[model samples]
Target: MTIVNQLKISAVSIKGAKALEQNLLEKISKEKYKPHDLFLSLEKISNIYNVNKTTAQRALHSLVGKNYLYQIHGKGTFVAPPAVTFQVLVIADYETGTNNDFGSIFGIPAFLRGVLKKIDLEKYNYSPVMLTKKKFIEILPDIELIYRSCRGVIFFRNIDIFVKTLPVLKDKNIPSFFYGSDALLESVSNADCLVYNEGGITDLAINHLLKLSHKKISYLYIDESPTQKKRFNLFLQENKKYKFCTENDILYFKTIKELIHNNIIPDIKRLLKNGITAIICGQEEAGVYFLNKCLMAGIKIPGELSVLTISNYPICALTPVPLSAVHIPIEEDAGRCLELLIDIIEHGSKSEKHISKTTIVRRLST
Candidate 1:
């Protein structure tokens, strides 16, 4: 699902899907789609080709991965001409799933859009290079070369990358901007960072759940980063004011996939038995899964178990019960951070630190 049309071409094994892809790619290659000419929508492609929506999607993705087409999430795909003369390098994890773009994650799209709006498109277009954390470090030297060439950079990923990349940017004098919470910056040094007030989620969590007098609140998360652990700990300390949660009322996982695959029936049964009236999830995916499991167990949401997550991913809207979330101003922060980097690159402005704003979005799950 790595749709780097400029870098890789994937083999499409499905006969019908590959044929559709070939048809579309051939037209695109023949310049049927002029520069910036929007490609057909999934529904339109499906109806015209007499194929399923999945086949149409795969076809479009094949072209994008082959660099024949490029997508702008809500905006339709378009034929790509010669590569843009890119000045800014945006680094993001290439989420390995079909239909995922830079905007697939919660905060990234907003941040990316905000940054894009401020970018001087005539002088500097952005080159987004998406790679997983492991992939980035595996090709660290190659990555550094790309960084050295860029006028500026926008980064969002693991601290390992931050630790390695910040120094390279510093040494090369390529201004860099980082996006994450303040907790992520604890171990890192001398990096210009944009920290969204992710810690405010705890305030949102406490206010919403406590207002309802939810006793025996449970917190669950994948402690993949310091912020996740910090958020869980912060919740614990804050809840101490009311003494709502205890030792057995919390659980965690190493990954979201593990949390999804592992049976949560026992956890649900035990928590309910222990008088757990509400639950706070550190991620939206976990909130969705919890709701699904609760439905299966004939449990009423908010009635039996109030659920809230710290994310505002689109899945919140898609879930049966729209998930309550804390909306951090990562998008706003990213735009400002990008402006900072751009100014440093063009005007030799000094790099500085800034924190993002945070707020709550309540839905039925709360």
Candidate 2:
């Protein structure tokens, strides 16, 4: 054979080996194939790849570390499906929860579920993964593992963790998105977000109270989130108009129990001290808690203090006050959030952040 022809033949042999390796990897990605099936008789893949049984064994061993396949003592080798997309991993966050309170933890998940229900799953088969408030830094390795399995992620109510891992996703060309209130507003340009319109919603709740002639308002809030802070701040800004209705002004509290523990019974003390007669809660859960506290303190509702909230908790009606509240459009917001996430994943648009508005729903106790 000519020297040049020999060189060409050698190159083809090397190329073929590499091609076989890639082909196996792709098969793993495409289906849940088992290594035992590939090595069913050892003679099978050998003929298929035109490689000796020893070379095939070496290739299979190399893929073991890559998580493409697994070995079973009695059964055989099994192939794992390619890691699912971002949505598949994040679905947990979209499931319904017991209550709608930040402190409840399930509130965010329930809201996400409401959103995911409206999304076209065929196009965006992603899931919402939950990360604890302080576990971001320690979770990088696991996050990286998921990255190898899936190409995208939908982070839920987790900013610090998302920020820490987002750069890695960008480096690996993995798409990352956020839903609900974003803790990393500046990094928002790098990630898509479906944020809640706390300002508009708080405005709606405050306006609802105003229509009820509730001038003496106090807001019982938990400052665990930036979103809640903005809601409280906006409520204060709108409280300026209450001066026109009566001298009873608005006040803020960190926690319902804290106010009581500090001997500062906001509803009762307000009535006796400042003549404050109405309350607007940051969330419906807190509204219920406050209403119960008021009743225990012998405070009359609507006759002494009207209670309203910014969130919708069905249990609010069971409260002694039968609290009134503005319903946050959680279901609609979820749909819009998933739609925006899909837009980011498919079209690569990272400039605009979608914010859904909150609407007021008047009920008793107003």
Candidate 3:
């Protein structure tokens, strides 16, 4: 027999059990049980309906099969929300000429893997929506449709888009969780956030160098994102504690393109002459390039100069001198983002913001 026929045959054997199931569904639809509210157990079901345990079980299972209820393994069944579709939308930033052509340089693939690992496939469906800044406006109507269809949204590396779309999402009462730095969260009110502690990473990298008796440290950064600005500010604050490198030691390039096109060789030589013995790089790509230039200029790693990258990219491991880095916990942050989003969806409550800590991954360069 076909699956539908088998389900019908099973329902017939239970007798009057089908009526019991409909009554239960009616109560659920009438808001007798709120979303995430627990349902009766097998014993309670049988007692209340004056039916056998087998009949109660069949009735409950039938409701589950119809998506009227959901059960957690080892935990009891709960009243499913009205229109509980079990779909989550993940919106990611897209950048041209980058790994995955989107996301941060550290690796979008690893971040996505972390999210997937934490998600329960049997209970939820995951859908990803990637768009560049230019494309977002053009396809916004379609995005609205997509947003309305999903239960909640998880945003990654797309602060601009998130900010722009926040109003509409709020109007529709859709819960959203942002996976980004604390600075990014400051703009949006009432939304859940899973932040990467950019300031903490700066502290970890700078403190490690200070302990090594390296005072004259320079910092390099590319891009003007809020997260990058926060890192730069934290580096300055830490430098104040030690009276290390002066204002001149801090450098900024508007974009990675600017960093590549401009020759900063003379500037590096000047810093080296000024007793700058160590450098903290904020961007991974720019850091790798600076390391190559320093090596080519006959600068010794750690002996004459030391370098530390503020990134957790796998490429850091394969570099000529494995780069010492303040490793951002991308995987942990992604997992936390998923967990928080799900909590908001199930309980209909806004979760408090969370910040993941960073760790220093020591390697040859430091």
Candidate 4:
């Protein structure tokens, strides 16, 4: 049966139930919630649609078996919020004539939507603007003029652009936030941020790998940026306690080409031959790239070399082997950053910084 028909067949119930279900479906259709988050609380639904409790409960019950809402043993129901939108302003060298950078502003955008359900606007009002580093420098006067009109500005990619522009905002008392791993912020040391917990996240992933009986664990990364270096150090620091991973056990790579140039495949082969059975990645994109590289070299994942990634990027879910990753609480962190910025703009609170916690999601690829 068609999905729509199936829903229609099941939605036919009491008048109030039908009305409540219609209200919810309309919200879902308009909001485009993921399939995983359809169950809504009867109380909330009733309160939102102004229906009686019975009708709301019946309406939710009708959606129960239709894959719209699933009930847990004891926890109350929750309807997922609509998709989120985060607008990031990036200044970078896009035409460097190399492969495109793996990171994007989309991850934090998706995350913000999930956590900021209480906000009236779910999507960002402005379009994300990408400017070349030179263009950004040249257009600073005009850019600052344009920036004044924006409700909020999110910066990724170039730390220099942010570092320079931030002074302007600081002078003007304009609230702004940065989202990424590598941004030089000693000048704006007091600015708010939504960044990975390089030390804590790496420590957790390495500890997990150590417990899995993998002695010689290799570290994979994209750029030798400060954030990646911090993560590499954290990985080694955590493993150092176990005596299995000394300086030799930790390996840092600049890029895919560099890894290949230095004969990484041969080195990995040697590690495997010498009983290295796992690898931890500094970021999700690097993890996916490393996994592909290992596969090309005919190495099996988990069975031969367990793989773990630090950042939880979207590609992890779609990879051949879903990656086990320490996920930054990006959405919650972004939402909190937005809230803090808005509050400071309105109330003029004087806070220094906002930091979010991280957690590990053990998936199939671990």
Candidate 5:
């Protein structure tokens, strides 16, 4: 095995074989020593580096162990084909409360649990990262290195980072998939995305309630997020479809305080007195808070006023009444993402992309 003109390298000979090792790594990663190309023989490296054959052999074996090069029984060493790494750059958005382990975070987020569960641990390494949007410009260089190093990326609910990093990823030829809601991501189109059909949640919930003989269904929620607004608009559309538009059927709360700590008894009694037989909550946490308030008021869920919710996470499932809800198929979406990513890594970005569907999980609350 031979590589010409790399006859001499000097980087603190005290670092010894380590410097020689770095030189070889630079050559391979830069594609100077390409796949199946013979690397410098141990004898040549030993002479060039002015190191013992044992030291050169150790350096060669280190690259072999890392799969950068391979040694045939009697044929010396040759560069191995660049292996597609299992490392995936998982990007997460952080608010006031969260954590990060260096570039990667430690604890898994609720949405990420399903993703991690469906990921092949033996073949894939999921790296969760949280970089603040405010610091985006400052961290651009570090972010670029991350994109270049990873074979693929899995981003959850971080549209800003996903959009900003797309160009760098394209420059590095890295494939990425961002899982989020349709409402929040409607404007972006260049990257692969798994969108929670926010409107579908409204359709599913409304259809379910209407089928159960619920004519006077009202919409209620705090935190008018994009997904919530989308859900509400869809609900209005559905109501229009059935010619059931009534201003009294919609209740909007300004904050979580209004749903939780603020007086809600009058609101509950008002709905019942007005023959509002059911309520569709825009957010699961809001629904849970409302449910607890109802229970405190001795109101029977489903029996008195059926409760339906749009579940972005597992908040509804943890309830005592098991609220009937329109759910994002979190695990299914994640599984599909994993499959799509594997296909992209193996067959290129032209590999067919598939998006998972929103679903309805019926329970006692409805």
Candidate 6:
């Protein structure tokens, strides 16, 4: 053979051997064979790949050099310790005990479920770290350890907590993204955010009520966060265009405990007396509470009061009168955020914001 042809053939063989080495490593990782049990004779690899013994030997030697496998003096080649996996950390404002109960939390569980479903298990692993408002300060010292271990982070929390904790991740140059409505604010400009359009959700709710010819409506909420504020503000903004409700019709409570202690039923009675026909609720729990209270007061749903919730959980359907709602696409948004995070990690791309659309799900309550 000509020298040029011989050189080209030799290069092809080397490339083939390298490819075989990668395939072997992937196989070892997938099978999870013990180091001693993974030892394979040169003949075994040759037969497995249908390559010559010299090619197998070259591939095995390359793996050994890269610490993917080890060779002993007399023993055959063995798999090395598994390579460290890329970890994506998820931080959210929730207690560990409430992790499994979607009703107790907001849409966080649904969002997390979507993220878990879409993550590439072969290339990356995820660790969910729940942090409550009370425990956030306690976890500050351990932030460095978390930052060092995780390649990226996905945050779903209030603006205050996010603003406080984000600096640690930023200091380490770790890629991160915010998932939820709190990320919509100008204060959250630093991180890439996947936000549900509060305006769109509010518009959907108000438009639905308007279509139903409900003129006197009210907006109700229990908590005051940036997200809640956005929803409430959007409700007000949309009300201006529709003229369905006024500022006096808005009802808010500091907490659920306060709502009960102050007797929310009495307020509902008063709202009904004032000719309020429909209510748009910011929190799902608040929607449930209002529905129950209205029912207990012998108020006929959709006949006397039409309730609509801006939430993600399907529990709304289980109520006495299945609630109509502006359903936020929590799972889809979560998956999109994870995809964006992976893109940034793999491609060194600039972080970008995404706004997920909301749709009104018509049901008995409306």
Worst 10 residues of 6 by lDDT: 97-106
lDDT of 4 by residue, 54-142 (tens): 67778877766454556776886545433334333444455552543444444534544633442545333333455566776675666
Local lDDT at 157 for model 1: 44
The residue-by-residue lDDT of candidate 2 on 172-278, one tens digit each, is 66666676554346555645677766666666776777777766566666554346556656556665766422324434456555544554464357453665667
TM-score leaderboard ranking: 6, 3, 5, 1, 2, 4
Q: Residue 23 deviation, candidate 3, in Å? A: 30
**Of the candidates shown, which would achieve the greatest TM-score relative to the real structure?**
6
TM-score of each: 0.66, 0.63, 0.70, 0.62, 0.69, 0.73
**Superior candidate under TM-score, 4 versus 6:** 6
Candidate number with the higher TM-score (5 or 6)? 6
lDDT of 5 at 146: 47
lDDT of every model, 2 decimals: 0.71, 0.61, 0.74, 0.63, 0.70, 0.73
Candidate 2 stretches greater than 4 Å from native? 1-88, 91-102, 115-139, 142-147, 182-190, 221-241, 244-257, 260-267, 283-285
Per-residue alpha-carbon lDDT of candidate 5 for residues 102-198, written as tens digits (9 for 90 to 100): 1113123545566667665565644434445455445556765644545677777677777877787778677878787776676676567777766
Per-residue lDDT of candidate 3, residues 204-254 (tens digit): 888898888897788887765446546657667755866667777766788
The per-residue C-alpha lDDT of model 6 at residue 175 equals 78
Query: Model 5: runs farther than 4 Å from truth?
Result: 1-69, 72-85, 94-108, 121-138, 144-148, 226-245, 351-353
What's the distance in Å from true for residue 103, model 3?
4.2
Please list all clashing residue pairs in model 5, or write none if there are none: none
**Per-candidate RMSD, Å:** 17.5, 11.4, 10.3, 15.1, 10.3, 6.5
lDDT of 1 by residue, 70-187 (tens): 8998888887875645456666664533343213555556666777666665655654445556665565566546554467667774556777777765776667777777776778
On the 0 to 100 scale, the lDDT of residue 358 in model 3 is 80
| lDDT winner | 3
Distance from true position, residue 363, model 6, in Å?
Answer: 1.8
lDDT (C-alpha) at residue 267 in model 6: 75
Model 4 poorest 10 in a row by lDDT:
80-89
Arrange candidates by lDDT, descending: 3, 6, 1, 5, 4, 2
